[model samples]
Target: MGELVDRVDEQDRVRGVVDRGEAITHHWLHRVATTVCRDGEGRILVHRRAADMSRFPGQYNFLVGGAAEVGESYEEAAARELTEEIGVRVPVRFAFKFLCRGEISPYWLGVHDAVVRTDITPDPDEIAWHAWVTEDELREMARRPTFVADSLYALDRYLSRGEAARADPLP
Candidate 1:
């Protein structure tokens, strides 16, 4: 069997459990938790995904995250994904959630924000290339041909919140 995922409904309620592969194969709705990571300088972390990844291979994504497992809250999933992908265990605050009409499958995306006070150890299997960029640089990268579409959506919504959204600004 493959990784188990929590299948969700239109309302974002858990409906049942399915293997992540099955969910993707059948186009079942699931919860995906991701984060926008920034450094102390407020530069966003942009990464080129490893080309061997099953989903969005070799794509440039601003958000780093994956499917929420069964019984995992979006926040929990976000924190876990951060640690798994970027080797960070910092406090991740929820930013927003949206149903992404992804290119491969549909899923609810839970977006979070976290400031990295420490250096990140990116897993080579997940991140092929990484660099911290200013918002303007990110904006330019977003226009690239290989950028992930869903991540672009998340970035748009994150920016829509303006500077007054989060209580404490990025450290």
Candidate 2:
């Protein structure tokens, strides 16, 4: 049996439940939770996916998370994924959400961000290498094709929103 995931519609409403594999294979819209973990020095944590993983193996990803389970809320999935992938249990706040309509995999992504004060221990099965990099460094890296598309999209969206917020001064 495969992992069960909540199948969502274009508006991110859960319509039904399906196996993760089937959802991916059929390009069905599903719910995913992503977390951008920042360190004490204000650097974002990124990791290289393990080469043996089914999707985007050996690629760098800015966020640490996966699909939302059958009955799990976005917040619960974010925290659970953080703990499962990076061995950290911290409070993650919702940043934004977007519908990623890719050719192969389409899903509604719930983007979250958190400042982790503790150390991170990446699971070898999920991550090959990890690093903490500044925004400029991340932008330089984004120039290359090594980073995962979905993660990059989320990061770009998040960064753009930050810039917009800064431009709007408080009255």
- Which candidate leads in TM-score? 1
Model 1, CA-based lDDT? 0.90
Off by over 4 Å in 2: 163-171
Candidate 2 C-alpha lDDT tens digits along 62-109: 888999999998899999999999999988888789898854599999
lDDT of 1 by residue, 22-91 (tens): 9888999999999888888778999999999988999999998998889999999999999999998999
Candidate 1, position 91, lDDT: 91
Candidate 2 deviates by what RMSD? Answer: 3.5
Q: After superposition, how far is residue 152 of candidate 1 from its true place, in Å?
A: 1.0
- Where does candidate 1 stray beyond 4 Å? 166-171
